[model samples]
Target chain A: QKEVEQDPGPLSVPEGAIVSLNCTYSNSAFQYFMWYRQYSRKGPELLMYTYSSGNKEDGRFTAQVDKSSKYISLFIRDSQPSDSATYLCAMIRDNYGQNFVFGPGTRLSVLP
Target chain B: DARVTQTPRHKVTEMGQEVTMRCQPILGHNTVFWYRQTMMQGLELLAYFRNRAPLDDSGMPKDRFSAEMPDATLATLKIQPSEPRDSAVYFCASGLTRQGRNEKLFFGSGTQLSVL
Candidate 1:
C-alpha cells in the first residue's frame, strides 16, 4: 500500500457549505500532520499543522488527526469561493530533517 | 515579506539538455527542500538539505538528477540529459528545524519545466 492515500476529488459545493477532506496513512510511525492549499499555477502553501491526535482550529478551517485510526481530516466551515483550490495532506515521522510524504491533493471548487 | 524565491519561473528545454533550477530560500532558514509536482506523481520529494548539507536524497533518481547547496543562500537542482517525463513544476521550500522538529515551510512560486 502507498504510505499515504487521499481521494483525488474535484468536490464541488455551494458557498457556505461545510467541506471535509480526509486522508489515510498506513505508516504508524507518522507523527506530524499538515494540510497545504494550492491555487492554480501557484505552489502549495501551509494551511494547517498539527502534531497530536486531536483537532486544531484556525478561523474557518480545522485540522483533525487520529493516530489510532491513522486517518486525518481538514474541515472548512462556511466555505467561500476563495477556498477553491487543491488541498494536500502531508506528514512526516518525528525526526530531524526527515522528508515529507504527501498525498495526492483533492481539488475543491466552492461555487458562488 | 519573507518567502522563498525561485528564478526562471518557466523553462522549456529539449531532451538530453541540462536544466538547472535555482532557489533563494528565506534567510535564516536552515532547512531546504526540493519537490516535483505532477498530475500522476502528486508531490514527490526529490531531496532536502539541513545547514547546507544534504540530509536525504533517496527520492531523487541518481542517474540524471543532482541537488546541491553551494552556499547558504542558494540551492540548485540540476537534471542532465532531461527527458519529456521530467516536465513538472519544481518547488523550493525553507524552514527552521529545532530540537529535531521541522517547522512551517515557506514555498516559492515554483519553476514550470517542459522537456521537449
Candidate 2:
C-alpha cells in the first residue's frame, strides 16, 4: 500500500458550500501533516499545516489530524470558485530536511 | 512578501539533451526542496537541502538527475540525457527548517519541462 492515500477526487461543489478533503496514511511514524493547494499550471501553495493530532484553524480553513487513525483532513468554509484546485496532503516524520511523502491529491471544483 | 523564484518557467528539449532548472529561495530560509510532478506520479520529492548541505536525494535517479545548492539563495536541478518520460513540472520550495517539523513552505512558480 502507498504510504499516503487520498482520493483523487474531481469533487464538484456549489459556491459557498463547505468542503472537506481527507487523506489516510499507513505510516504511523509520520508526525506532521500539511495541506497544499495547486492551481492549474501553477505550483502548490501551502494552505494549512498541523503537527500530530488535533485541529488548527486559519480563517476559513481548518486542518485536522488524527494520529491514532493515521488520518488528516482540511475543511473549507464558504468555498469560492477561486478555491477550485487540487488539494494535496503531505506528511513527514521530522524536520524539513527529511523526505516528505505526498498524497495523490484531490481535485476540487467550486462552481458559481 | 518573500517568495521562491524560479527561472525559465517553461522548457522544451530533445531527448538526450541536458536540462537545468534554477531556483532562488526566499531570503534567510534554511531549507530547500526539489519536487517533480507528473500525471501518473502526482508529486514526488526529488531531493532537499538544509543550510546549503544536501540531506537527502534518494528519491532521485542518480544516473541522470542531480540536485545542488551552490549557496544559501541558489538551488539547481539538472537532468542529463533526458527522456520523454522525464517531462514533468519541476518545483522548488524553501522552508525555515527540516522535514517532520512545522515549517511553512514557500514555492516557486515551477518549470514545466517537456522532453521531446
- Candidate 2 local Cα displacement, residue A39, angstroms: 0.8
**In model 1, where do residues sit more than 4 Å from their true spots?**
none
Candidate 2 lDDT over B61-94, as tens digits, reads 9999999988898999999989999999999999
DockQ of every predicted complex: 0.83, 0.62
Candidate 1, residues A1-112, lDDT tens digits: the string is 8899999989999999999999999999899999999999998999999998999999999999999999999999999999999999999899767878899999999999
**Residue pair clashes in candidate 1:** none
Q: In candidate 1, what are the lDDT values of residues B58-107, reduced to their tens digit?
A: 98999999999999999999999899999999999999999978888878
Best by TM-score: 1
What is the Cα-based lDDT of residue B34 in candidate 2?
94
